[model samples]
Target: MFRLAAAAACALALGLAAAPAPTSAAERLTLTSQYGPGKPQTLLWERFAEILERERPGAYDINIVTNGALGGEKEEAEAIRLGAITGAESTIANLTTWVPLGAVLDLPFVFQDAAHIERVLEGPLGDELKAAYRAEGFETPAFIIFGARHLLGKTPLTEPGDVDGLTMRVLQSDLHVALWRSLGANPTALPITEAYTALSNGVVDAMDMTKSGFEALKLYEVAPVLTETAHIWAVGVVYFDANFWAGLDADERALFQKASEEAAAYFNEIAAEEQEAALQRAMALGASRAAVDQELWRAAVAPFVEDFVRNMEDPRAVDALEMIQEAR
Candidate 1:
């Protein structure tokens, strides 16, 4: 019995020694988002993390903190730029606060359609934006096209005239405020986190948001009317801290590049599905929709677009618009 016990102990020790230990702890990177799980942007980050793990197993331990666990858009963008947090999913409107050239993309009707968007993203415009953002401590790896922004209201709101004299919830960007003001609305800049509550309490009568966000935040319940302005397609980026990016070696950078491209393609594909489903979900929840004469909205904003480009702080804003127009 003693001999058998000793033999068992020796065999167990040998087996443990034969097994290989883990190479090293995976590099920890945390990404922030204002959307929770099942939302498009949150899914985009999850897809990105999955691709990284697939390409280099055990090399990256990526954590996606959702529903603004880190902060809202403005705070998260600042965090990424400061390297206080590793990364975040952010919009061009948010970045325009830092890089004014980004406002070109925010112009109404800049993107004619999906194919036009594809041309611009695959063209020199993306490269230009990437370089510009890198100068501002953000290493923008991927460009994503989210759903278009539309007007939402508790009342049956439909045309450019409908928003006139209404208190509107605008993004935490001056550009959004200026755009809504041009339409004759009283624009008030507010973080998306406060949009629902503001709408609930009559602080704001109308607001603009993407289809997916309208559904994800259940703003459809508060503002039960959706006007499909399809004004500006929400172009967003996977922004990483430039310092964090600089610390990566060539091989690691290559993995990130590949992962970003794959994940972006994945996002654009499913985002359309999510947008369609969002409307259906909203309708089921007692929401109503109105069709807009898009050409009218386009005409209304044409002058504002021109003025916005002219007054932009960045000279390259003109060049950015030229690239997008050339692509079209």
Candidate 2:
């Protein structure tokens, strides 16, 4: 009787000591962005990390890589595609490589304000774009507002005619190139990292960038004239590789989704404030600000829009343009 009891006790002790096969370590999630630490985007992601931890404790540990430490925008995007990186915050232009429909967001003068942009992106159009990203092996968690684009140049650009014959640096997007060319400028596509040198060396005379971007990059030091063209409102997308997203548990996924939505909204608010502050900083630094002649600029670039509509193979491009016009 005592032997059997001892055996039973041993079994019970072993069962208890086994510790339920030891729960696996949480999956690691890494998020990369070109912006430096302490930037609004980084702070937004930091909050996202807190949300993930609180909502899905022990399920995920998020690591944020900032300041292009992994790579510049394009390289970071390519890394996500190859699964070398799990997540990133990149411009719609970068996402266009996976989904051509993304280029639709870059249509110049499409959105007048943040509210208009929010309505379009948070509505059916945004959902459709998200679905397209899913089909392309990505999970677009949220789209963050990047604020309105402005013109920064060595020479004043009050109208489209002023842009003529000027070599302007543009994002490495075909649409951006087309837009600048349409305005009569010699557009050169370069990565944001190279833009500072390009402007300093006179390789490019002007560029269309966000006010915050201009201040952050210190481009105002080189380009003293900042024009409020407000041609297009830009957005940044936070996304994860589909394979990585799929590996996340239900609770983890929910956490990410919720966190992203909240972060995006917060980012929009911060972006607006930063844009105004950047403008003030630029002005303080001796940069001049001028109002652009929208009518003249529109007339000069009308041909380019017509050409794009006529020759562009992507039907979504036309649809997006029509949608923006209707919204206006």
Candidate 3:
């Protein structure tokens, strides 16, 4: 009888101990991007969110904010720094705040193809760049390469001569300014959000942006001609604030990093496919698309590249340029 009673007591104790505690809700994380939802940037974030939810369960959740709804890239970056936001997908141009040396990546014609970009960015050099951001109080999970930048204009641009005396909208980067100036176009730096209106209002006759950006911004509606000059292959970095990152336990951090890298690879593959699709879609929408004369663009931009190389004091910048050229 005593044995039976003891067994019952033990079973009851086990049952009480095994009862699950209330599952805490997942912590919601917000990721801000300059592009609109349904675009490439937001698509990457969505994939990341899915992976995070699957891997971390109740650990973390991601909410993507796009279309400058949270403000422009610069503003969003500042928010991340101030701990007002958790993460952001930012262009190298905007990332210049944390790592000024990153601006070198914006130079025209530096990265020849996606393979070349991937090799450099996922290799030792890319690791170094990631560390640079870490030093500035951020966590860089992975860098994703986008399609090559091309010139889209209201007027046809087959060669450098066509751009002469044209007012061109460019990102506020010294490298971009130098490249545009060398090509004889008047360079005006403006935020990406204002680019569409500026183009429609005739504030700028030409702009350099990826084919996907052209489609997303509906720039094709106004600028009917897109020249595949392929001047620059831009890259976007996924970053988290160091404080928020450090708060995560080891397993959570590993899960986030793995998910981010996978999402970045997915973004690169999708971006390549979308680049051709965007061009085809533009043509269907009554836009004329053509390839630029490489020789002419190279000739016009060579001097600018030379000047840039001479002025750059960072050996890593020079090495990155050379490595990319060699890979090409």
Candidate 4:
């Protein structure tokens, strides 16, 4: 009888211990990044979640999903808009589907260097861009750097002429198509997932990508050549769902914004360090590196830039371009 009573007492103790403790009202948010684990983009979101939880204590809990577990950027973006998910990361180029002016960031040669890109995105130009996102129902525009995009090709790109007649993979943005076409390459729009197979099988001859992307996708094994074109300052922006954001109090919003800003600055530093490492890794894997003929490539693409600017319907496009150029 004593053993039976002791067992009953121990069962009661275990039950109580297994039950969750009572806590204050807490909101749960889901944040997703498409990048795989250990990539800077994935790590940045992880740190952001940590900051949010630390700031709010039991008031909020943020769950992060990495490696496109939810979906690719576009699919995740649509989900966020419908309030299916709380938030996701996106490139300015990809955001063009919602905000046409987002293409301004993807235009080649607009940013002279990383510093110039940073200044524009952190200044009035960025303010305008953020306002556009907010107007369209996204909130807290946080910029994430993916480093400078370079040419990854099956053959060496010694001059602008080398790209002529070669089929190159491009993003799903019209501007990318126009840019590559202007360079005399036939631009093919392929989802990044298919790029490795396409390159290895000779379906496409070249692609424009960042060191981080090249390394992450292991495309060097197929392409084997990295040209330092640094054509555009590749960037991705993170925005929250408008409904979810509006539900948050001012303090909550401020806390998130602060965390995003600090995290972006931190990410840029890490990207700089990773850039050298990615280059070394690619070279060690038997990839050849080459210098681009910038002047020649710029001269070839100048007409396209002018035509693009002349066709902008929004006057804000002119102002944005001016601000970007002055930063250089």
**Maximum-TM-score candidate:** 1
Candidate 4 global CA lDDT score: 0.77
Q: Write the per-residue lDDT of candidate 3 for residues 13-127, one digit (tens) a residue.
A: 3344332433667586777667877788888889999898777576764566677665566666666666666888878777775686687778777776788888777677788
Candidate 3 global CA lDDT score: 0.79
Backbone clash tally (model 2)? 0
Q: Each candidate's lDDT (Cα)?
A: 0.82, 0.78, 0.79, 0.77
Error of 3 at 284 (Å): 1.5
lDDT of 2 by residue, 68-185 (tens): 6655677666666556667877788776766777777777766778887777787777888899888887889899889888899986788877888999998877788888887689
Error of 1 at 28 (Å): 1.3
RMSD of 3: 13.1
Question: In terms of TM-score, which candidate is stronger, 1 or 2?
Answer: 1
Check candidate 3 and list the clashing pairs: none
lDDT of 1 at 60: 73
- The superposed Cα distance between candidate 2 and the true structure at residue 81, in angstroms, equals 0.9
Q: Candidate 2 clashing pairs? A: none
- Which 10-residue window of candidate 2 scores lowest in summed lDDT? 13-22
lDDT of 1 by residue, 82-190 (tens): 5556888788888887888887888889888777887897778788889999999999888888878888997766677888899999887778899999989999888
C-alpha lDDT (0 to 100) for residue 306 of candidate 2: 69
Give me the displacement of residue 321 in model 1, in angstroms: 1.8
